[model samples]
Target chain A: MMKATVYVTIKQGVLDPQGVAVQGALHSMGFEEVSSLRIGKYMELQLDTNDRAEAEQRVKAMCEKLLANTVVEDYRYELEG
Target chain B: MMKATVYVTIKQGVLDPQGVAVQGALHSMGFEEVSSLRIGKYMELQLDTNDRAEAEQRVKAMCEKLLANTVVEDYRYELEG
Candidate 1:
């Protein structure tokens, strides 16, 4: 089996309210050294096949089709078996 | 300056409703090659300091105290300067 780990992050210019909230919370908790924080989504997929090239293609397609909002987010993935 | 990328994933045996929903959506969209999917959180931190060791320490503390729910999630981070 092959395991794919995908990271989906908001585009640089996009507004991230959840990230802002988390940063505020961190500062309030006395972690004031944090300059900025941006939050996104992480996903892991376990595939039954072991073809690395095919896995990458499928995962990329999956990201574009369902895992991420391409207009506002960008995705990258790592594959391992 | 240093940038940290943190990945927070659901612990094994923990329930992930969001992941389940996404997997179902993928199946509906005909990406049936996916056997299992787990969704988590990804965070990026931009710090004003350039100390690699310090960045790792602070980011780990941040993850433990705020970024991740240790009871149900596990976190790992990579630092780049």
Candidate 2:
């Protein structure tokens, strides 16, 4: 089986309200040293395949189709056995 | 200087439309081998501080305040020199 880890994030220019809210909460929790924070998503998948080429092809398709939003998000993945 | 890397993702049971769309795209691209895909975000921050405790406090605050949405997102971060 092949395992893949994917990371996704919003584009820099977009506004992130969620990040702002978390920063505020941290400050209230006696963590006043914080400056800024941004949030993203992570995913892990296990595939039943051994071919690297096939894995890449499928992963790339996955990223382009459902793993990432081309309009506001970018995604990358790492594959391992 | 303190550098931190933050990762954020949608909690399980949350709907990820972006992830779903990417999956569809990948399938069309001849990557039918993929079973599932989830998307998330990654962030790298450069801070001007050296104290580990202080850094942690600040980073944690950032995560809680703005880096993540407690309702729908989860976050984690790493600290480095």
Candidate 3:
């Protein structure tokens, strides 16, 4: 089996209201040391295959087609067996 | 300056409807090699301090207070200066 970990993050130039809100909340909760914050999605996947190359390719396809919106978000994945 | 990366994930045995939905979608999209899936949150935080220990402690507190739901989720973080 192959295990894949994927991270989907907003593009650098994109606005992240959720991150802003969290930063504001942290500041209000007295964590004034926080200067910048960004939130993203992390996913773990278990695959039935053993081939690393195939797993990587399939994972990339999955990220491109279903796991991430390529227009505004960027995705990267790591695969291990 | 310090950077912290945090990951917040649901506890084992918790039903993740969103993950289920994504798995289903992936299967329908022809990625039947997937066996299991879990989804979580990833956050990147920038702290204005240079002290590693202080940054770690504050990041932990931040996770406990707002990032992860103590009752249902688990959180872990890595810090770098």
Candidate 4:
């Protein structure tokens, strides 16, 4: 079996209102040391195949096809057993 | 300055409808090899402090107070320059 851990993050220069809101909340809660904050999505996938090459290709395809928005977000994945 | 990358994930046995929906979509899109799937949140935090220990404690406090719901989610963090 193979597992793919994917992280999908907004590209730089994109406006992240969610992050801003969280940061504001943190500041209100007294965490003034938090200078910046950004949020993203993380996914874990399990595949029935063990072929590293095939897993890589498939995981990449998955990211492009459904896991990420190529225009606004960047995705990277790590595959392991 | 210190950067903390935090990963927040649902605890095992929790009802993850979001993950299920995504898995279903993947299966329908012909990714039948996908045997399991889970989704979570990733956050990048920039701290203005140079103290690693202080940053670690503050980040942990942030996670507990605002970033994660301890009753249902598990969190881990890594700190770097």
Instruction: For model 3, state the Cα shift of residue B52 in Å.
Output: 0.8
The digit string of per-residue lDDT tens for model 4 on B8-67 reads: 999999988999999999999999999989999999988999999988999999999989
lDDT of 3 by residue, A1-81 (tens): 989999999999999899999999999999999999999999999999999988989999999999999999999988786
**How high is each candidate's TM-score?**
0.92, 0.66, 0.98, 0.99
lDDT (10s digit) by residue, model 3, range B1-80: 99999999989999888899999999999999989999999999999999888888899999999999989899999998
lDDT of each residue in B1-81, candidate 2, tens digit only: 787998877888998787777666666876666676666667766666888888887778776876678799888889998
DockQ of 1: 0.82
Least accurate stretch of 10 residues (summed lDDT) in model 2 chain B? Answer: B30-39
lDDT of each: 0.90, 0.75, 0.94, 0.94
In angstroms, give how far residue B73 of model 1 lies from its true place.
0.7
Q: For each model in turn, which proportion of the native inter-chain contacts is also found? A: 0.90, 0.60, 0.97, 0.96
lDDT of 4 by residue, A1-81 (tens): 998999999999998889999999999999998898999999999999989999999999989999999999999999898
Off by over 4 Å in 3: none
Q: Give the alpha carbon lDDT tens digit for every residue of A19-67 in model 2.
A: 6776677668765555766666677776779988888777777768766
| Quality of model 4 by C-alpha lDDT | 0.94
Candidate 4's C-alpha runs over 4 A off are: none
Q: Candidate 1 iRMS, in Å?
A: 1.1
